[model samples]
Target chain A: MRVENYSFVFAVFFANVFAWNPTPQVIEEQVPQTAFAQLLDFQNAARPEYNAYLSAGIIYLPLPSQSALLTEWGTHNGFAFRQRIGIWLTDNFDGKGSKGITFGLGWFGERQGWDNEDFLFVPNRGNFSQINQIHSWGLTIADSSKHWLFGGGLQYLNAKDESFRWWLLGTWSRFSIMPNFHKGDLQFINAQLFLQARELLGNENSWQNYLPDLEFSFYTKDSVKIFVSQNIFKQKYYLEGAFWARPQDFAYAALKFYPDPSRLLLALEATATKKDNDDIYFGGGITLPFLRVAYNHADDYESFFKSRGIWIVEIRLAIGSSGDSFFALKAPKAAPKEVKRIPMKKANFNSNNGE
Target chain B: MKSVKFLFLLLLGAFFSSCTHWLIDTETRIQVKNSTNRDIYELSVISPGKRIVLVPDTLKVDESSNVHVISWVGKFKFAIFVKNLPDSVYLGEYELKGGSIKAEIKGEDMALKMVLK
Candidate 1:
């Protein structure tokens, strides 16, 4: 099983790379060559550029609660660990306008760990005292235009160990409020709103009913990007801020040398809450093509705002698309003169699904 | 008039400072009744700002225990777990006050339920 899973992941990665390459092809005029050629002939046009993404990570939080931050330090601290994996496939049907459907599947599990500090303060057992697992599947339809972007989806979540399940309905919309600001390069400041609600199914029940997230993004020409978002989960509100930068011609040779300066990305983020009951997290991550690694530290009020010698590490692998266009690390160059097709709409060119 | 204003400001500051003590540690008594046929090796209560082990040893079937916890006065969501049990039960958000909170743990045909009163 493990070998099959590894082979599947590698195959998907190789296929994505092959599909994205803009290679020249020679077609025979007299005879049809193969089944693949026949399939291409049936479609007539070239294959649409689609994206597939897969991410997996492990989170450790000593203290566990509905309101507890997954990476926060101090309060209700316990040695608990949870692992999650998610996969998504999306493609656009209309050129220039990103009209597409996204299908996703996810699984998550938590493993309970024993408390080691019980002797310090009688009954001071660290938090990892519960086990919960979830499996989910989702489908979303999305459309993007010059002024508006919108999507909505229905997701099903089932508890692995209990008779609990729910259907979550979520919708999101983004609007480019103002015209692009040109300071040597063009940039746009955009705002987005996301909302989701859940309905309990069967006999089991849940506490949370709704979730909402609001965000604003600032994009410029291959320089820096700033994003701010406010999200609510489990009735607890959280605020996050991020800044990203990509420099030109930065490459590391894991094997052969590659000239994709845009493959390198550096990002810094902070996620916190207004209430002191939860810990705040500060972290940064770097992305290299198909891989990403991040580390974050949680500061807690219960521990006098100090790290309890704990760190959270997150790693992800994405197969479908490249990084955001704003972090391309190079300014746009003049289009090639021999243009056979009408230029793709600027709206699609500016859209960065990888962000 | 200036003296009166100064005195009022001082009194306001004192009141606000005293209110901060409202979150001082208080005793919370949790009563757990294991109404099952098998022994429970561990029973732990997991809350946002508090963690307390109600049963450190084996709690035999049909036994009850009153676990005393010291924490601030507020509502807490309890993530309760039993030893060797694959699943955990959640006692929805409840306020911690002077009275004893009761929870009955019962299972039938491999289905577990923790009813909080």
Candidate 2:
């Protein structure tokens, strides 16, 4: 099994590399000039755009804690490593009249180590080393006015755990509202809605319900952006606000900082509920070109802000071609082009046979 | 001893009332050998139950590729209507036929039946 899984990984890696390479066929088509220029424009606009990078990092709890008291069941603290690869599909359209769309897919897997000696407190006892895998796809569309951009799309997420299936719809627009607003070079608002399916597994009687999450990001400058996200799930509410800065644009990686291009990012999140398990998390991380690593601490306010001794570290990387266009370079000038249309056939075959 | 028995019964009742069941960790791995001169093509594993969905539905095989292996890690529960069960049940084995595969659980093992329609 291990050999097979590794072979599959190798196959996927080769396929991605093949896809990233700009063949002579592709180069002769003269695809990069306009796409590259558009990429630079989007970067300068201070909007959240997609880029390629490979990242592998580990998250450790560094503390022993459980939320059994707050909830009848909760996940335990552990350490896991995650690796993700992403690619871009489209680079540019034909100036303000050119419509462009970007799409990409990412796969991530994490393995958690467990203490085999621990007693069975949860329903699934003796199940050590939980392994979780997730696959995600995202799409973005925009019409560039050389100053304004707007579009939205849906992101589908499926994880090894059936309970993890969810969808997020996101819309964002960047426009210059006024000339005095820092040249309005990059002012954008984004909204995202996350939908979680209930009882996705076989548990038909579970109390779980769909959850909704929302977030907004605003780029105040070419180097700085502010965002606020609300995650409403598990009947609890979590609000987070963060400020991110990119001091160096020509770094070699996506999330990792170069020696001189490193910047400090700070985030504060508060989780509240009617129960006494409210928590506040303060985190800060350094952002580089290829990787981002951050340290977070959670404080339980109900416990008089007592330190939960919980720490979270997140590291993200980009693995593939830093810039590979996945979608059409130009958005349709008229109506959106339909990629696929399903035709209905063999209607009522079962009914016809029943007679 | 009497108190322990009473406690066990109470715990069992609580478990049943809460509709909570144990999560059984199951893992399956299958390897496809391309016996034909050409590649046997892609392979897919389908589950019989609506609650069961393959972690990955489509897998690609290269030309002359001898072995293509796929693995799934998850929990499986017996159907609610099944009664008088043995210690375990086996799910059937399946191979890609055209584009579909069939699977069933027979005890603790899954038996897969494959065809290329």
Candidate topping lDDT: 1
Query: How would you encode candidate 2's per-residue C-alpha lDDT over A1-355 as one tens digit per residue?
Result: 3445655743542332111111122222222221212222222222223332233443322212211111111122221222223333334421222234433333323222232111122322233333233333333343322212332222222222232222222223322111111132322333333222212111232232323222223334454333333333332223343334443221111121122111112223333222123233333344333334333222121111121322333344422221222121111011122468787686764686546
Each model's interface RMSD (Å)? 15.5, 16.1
In candidate 2 the C-alpha lDDT for residue B18 amounts to 26
Judge candidate 1 at residue A325 and give its lDDT: 19
Cα RMSD of predicted structure 2: 28.1
Report per-candidate DockQ: 0.02, 0.01
TM-score of the first chain in candidate 1 relative to the native first chain: 0.34
RMSD of each: 27.0, 28.1
> Clash number for every model?
6, 52
Q: Specify the poorest-scoring 10-residue window by lDDT in model 2 chain A.
A: A326-335
Tens digit per residue, CA lDDT, model 2, B1-117:
567557556754543232222221122333332222221223332334333223222222222223323223222222211123332222233322111222322221122223222
